[model samples]
Target: MATLARRALWPAVAAAASLIAAVLVAPAPAHAHGVALVPGSRTYLCYVDGLQANGQIIPSNPACAAAVAQGGQQPLYDWFGVLRPDAAGRTTGYIPDGEICGGGTTKYAAYNAARADWPTTHLTAGSTIQLHYSNWAAHPGTFHMYITKDGYDPTKPLAWSDLQSFWSVTDPPQSGGPGGFNYYYWDTTLPAGKTGRHILYIQWVRSDSQENFFSCSDVVFDGGHGEVTGVGGSQPSGSPSASRSASASPSVSPSASRSASASASPSSPAGGGSGCTATWALQPSQWAGHFQVNVTVKNNGSSTLNGWTVRWTYTGGQGFEGAPWNGTLTGQPPNVAVTNVDWNKVLGPNASTSFGFNATGTAPASAPALTCTSP
Candidate 1:
C-alpha cells in the first residue's frame, strides 16, 4: 500500500517540476515602448516593410531583411520597444558606441549595424516638418531630437559625439497616428545647410519612470518634400510638411561638414519627348564615402512602351560605386546611360519601374536632369 501511494505521487511531482522549469527559462518581456513614425526609425520602417496581412513578418528590403536574419522577428513585432529600462535620461557614456540606435539593448542589437542601406526619409534642409513619435504606452515625458554633426559619417557606427541636440519638446499633444499609427506629434525646423545623409536621433525620457526610449531616423537633406525611398512602397497617408512655431528651439551651427553636397530637389523628372520620363533619387549608399542613386522610369504614353533608355551626366564629378542594379550600365561616369533589363522591358501606359547604382565622389546639390529615349 505505501509503495503504490508513492508511485501515484511521482507523476504529480514531475509535472510540477516541469512547470517550474518552463517558467524559469522563459525570456523576460521588455518594458520599454514607443518609436518614431514619420521620418520613420529603423525598427519602425522595417516593421512596416515586413508586416503582412496574415500577421507574419517577411522583410523585402535588403537591409531590413539582413536585420531580421540577425535578430528574429520578435523585435519587429515590438517595433516600438527600442528602449532601456533604467536609462534615467542618461546619454553619451551610458549607451555604448555602435549601439545607440538599438538603445544599448541586446534584444535590439541587430539595428545597430552601420550599414547605409537602411530605409531613409528625404527632406529639404532648413525645412519645417511634422514630427511623429509613437506613443505605444503613453507616459509623461520629454522628447529630444538630435542631428548628426555635419561631418558625421553614415557608414560608421553612431556615437554620442556624432550628435547634437536640435529640438526638444515636453508633453507634446497626442493624435491619431498618420496612416493608422498613434503618436505624440509637433513641428520643428531642420538645421540649415544639411546635406547628403544624416541620422536624426530621438530620445524620450519619461518623467514618472526611469525608462527611456531611443530611435534612429535616417534622412537626407536633399530638398525633398517628405518622399521616402529604399523601402519600396507608398508612404503613410498625410503630408509630411508642417508649419514651424516659435515655441520650438532655434537651429544651431553644425560642428563639422562633409565634402558632399545635397541635391536641391533630387526627384526632378525629365521627359523623353516620346511620352517616357525618368526621375532621379538618392538611396542609402551603405559604404564609407559613397552614395547610391535610383532612376525611376515611367511611361506616360497612352500605348504600351516596348523598351527605354535613360542617360544622365553628373555635375559633381560623381563616379559609379558598383555595378548597376536592374539595368545595364553603358558609357562612363559624369556621362552615363542605363538600359532596361529583360524582366522590365515592357510597360503599360502610366506604369513605372526603377534602377539604381552605388557611386563614389561628391553628390550634386541638385539632381542631374535625365534624358529618356524609347526604341
Candidate 2:
C-alpha cells in the first residue's frame, strides 16, 4: 500500500513541474515585425520623470549620482509635477518635462526629488512596496534599468545593490522599431515613516544585446504612499485608433429604426439602386462551414454611403473574424454571434457590401435581421 501511494505522488509531482516549465518558456505573439529606425534616425525620443512623497525629496537612494555620471543632468523636470492628498488627491498624474531624452547621444535620465504632504500615509519601517512599469513600442527585445535610493552612489554597482530589476517585452526575437505595449510591476519597502525626500534613477538598454533604444517609464512605490512619476513619456497616444466591445446575446427592437429594400435588375448585372428607398432584402442565409456563417450586404439608401456599419444579435453560438482595421470573431460559441463593419468602405447611392462569420450552434428558425448605418 505504501509503495502504491508513492507511485501516484511521483506522477503528480512530475506533472506540476511540467506545467511550471511550460509557463516560463511560453512566448507572447509580437504586434510588430522589424527594426526600422536607428539611433540618429529622423525621429527623436522624448520622456518625462516625476515623483511625490511626504512633502520633500527623500534622499534615501543614490539616483542622482548615477544620472550625473551618464552626462545628461537636470533638476526634477517640473516642480509641480503632480500633487495628491489622501482625503482628496487621487495620488496619480504624469511627470514633468513631458519629453526626456531627445535629439542626441544622451543615455541616462533622472528624476531628482518627489515629496508627499503631511497627514499622508508614509511607508512604515522595513515595509515592501511595488512599482508598475510598462512599454509601448515595437522594439525587438527586453532591457534592464537601475534604481538607487537616497543620493547617487558612484562606487557601488546599481544593478547589484538590491535596487535594480530587469523586464522583457518581446515574445519572439525580431529586428527593432515600434512593438506592442508591455507592462511590469516592481516593489520595495521603506524604513519607518522617515519620509522627507526621495530620488529615482532610470537607465535603458536592450534585452538580448547591450544596445540602448528610445524610451521607458517606471512606477514607484514606497510603503502605502506612492507616485507614478517616471523618467520617460507615456506611450504615444491616438495612433491607429481602433477598439472593440462584445455582446453576449442579441437584442431586437419593437420597430425597425431604419429599413431598406432593393429591386434586382439585369441591366445592372450587379444590381440597381434608387436614391429615396429605405428598404432592403437579404438572400437566404448561407453556412460558411459547420462553424461559420456568411451574408451579402446591399445598399438601399437614397444617397451614396461613404461607409456603413451593421450590427445584430445572435441566439445560436456564433463568432466573428477580426480585421487589421476592424474586429473579428473566432472560436466556437455556445449560443449567439455578432458582426461589425468598418468605416472605410463607400457605397454608391444604391451600392452594397457583404461580410459575415462562423457560429457554433444552429441558426435560429428565423434568420437574424441586419441594420445599416450610413456616413
Candidate 3:
C-alpha cells in the first residue's frame, strides 16, 4: 500500500511541476507604446509600406530595409516606442548629435543615420495646416515641434541646434482610434521659406515621468498638397487633410506659446450626430500626472447595438497605456475614441457596457464631451 501511494504521489508531483514550469515560461505581453508622426513617422510609414497580407512586415523602402537588416524587426514592432523614457526633456547636451532621429537609442539607431533617400511628404511652404500626431498611446505633458533650419542637410545626423521650433502646445486635443493609433491634432503655420527636403523633429515629454517620445518626419516644401513620395503607397495616409476620423486640427491658439495651461476646444464628436449616450467619471486612483476613467456606454436604440464606438476629448493631454478589450483608445488630449472588441460588440436595447483606461495626465475639472454611435 505504501509503495502504491508513493507511485501515485510521484506522478501528481511531476504534473504539478510541469504546470508550474509552463506558467513560469509563458511569454510576457507586449507593453510597447509611443507616438508616430502622421504623414507617418519614419517607422510608421515604413511599417505601413511593409505590412503584408499575412500581417508580417517586409520592408519595401531601401532605408527601412537597411534599418531592419541592421537592427532586426523588433524596432519596427515597437515603432512608436523609439524613445528614451528618461530624457528629462533635454535637447542637445543630453542626447548626442546624429542620434536625434532615434533619440540616441540603439534599437532605432538606423533611423538616426543621415540619408536623403527616406520617404518625404510634400507640403506648401508657410502653409497654415492642422498637424496630426499619431498616438500609439496618449501621454500628458507637451509637444514641441521643430523643423530643421533651411539649408539643412538630410545626409547627416540631426543636431539639436539644427532645429527651429515653429510651434509648441501642452495638453493639446486628441481623437481616438482602434489599435492604439489615436491622434493628437493641432494647427500651426508650417515654417515659411522652406524649400526642398527638411526634417520635422518632434519631442513628446510626459509631465509625470521622465518618459519622452521622439520622431523625425521628412518633408519637402513644395506646391503639392498632402503628397507623400518614396514609400510606394498609392496614396498617403494620416495626413491632416486625409479622410480620417478626428483628423481636423485646431488652428494655433493666439498665444501659440509653449504653455501647458491653454484650453483646447473639444474635438468634434465621432459617430455622426448621435445615437447612444455616454457618461464619464475619472476614477479615484488619479494623481498629478495620471488618472483613469470609466466610460459607461448605453444603447438607446430599440434594437440591439450590434457594434458600437464612443468618441470623447479630454482637454488635458492624456495618453492611454494600451488597448481596452482589444478596442483601440487613440487621440491626443481633449480627444479620444474607443471602439468595441469582437467579444463585446453586441448590446441589446438599453444594455450597457463599461470601458475604461489608465492614462498619463491630470484629469480635467469636467468631462470634455462624448459622442456615441452604433452600426
**Each prediction's TM-score versus the true structure:** 0.55, 0.23, 0.56
* Candidate 2: segments with Cα more than 4 A from true spot: 1-126, 138-145, 149-182, 186-195, 213-223, 227-375
How would you encode candidate 1's per-residue C-alpha lDDT over 235-300 as one tens digit per residue? 222123422110010000000001012222456656575788987766432233455565778899
Question: Which residue pairs overlap in candidate 1's backbone?
Answer: 116-286, 177-181, 262-365, 263-365, 264-365, 321-358, 321-359
Tens digit per residue, CA lDDT, model 2, 219-301: 22232222111111221111111110111000010000001111111111122223211222321212222222333345666
- TM-score ranking from best candidate downward: 3, 1, 2
For residues 1-375, what per-residue lDDT tens digits would candidate 3 score against the true structure?
A: 011112334578776665555333321214555554444567766654453323345666688788878887666656667778789798888889988888888878988868876656666687765566765566788989998897898887788889998889898787664244456767677877888778888888889899888888877675434344545332222343332111111011100111111113221232332357666555433334545455556677777777777887656567764333224454444567788644346667766555555566666666667777876
lDDT of 2 at 189: 39
How far residue 67's Cα lies from its native spot in candidate 2, in Å, is: 16
For model 2, state the Cα shift of residue 287 in Å: 41
TM-score of 3: 0.56
Decide which is better by lDDT, 1 or 3: 1
In order, candidate lDDTs are 0.67, 0.26, 0.59
Tell me each candidate's RMSD, in Å, in order.
Answer: 18.8, 23.1, 15.3
Q: Which has the higher TM-score value, candidate number 1 or candidate number 2?
A: 1
Locate the minimum summed-lDDT window of 10 residues in model 2.
Answer: 248-257
Which window of ten consecutive residues has the lowest lDDT sum in model 1?
248-257
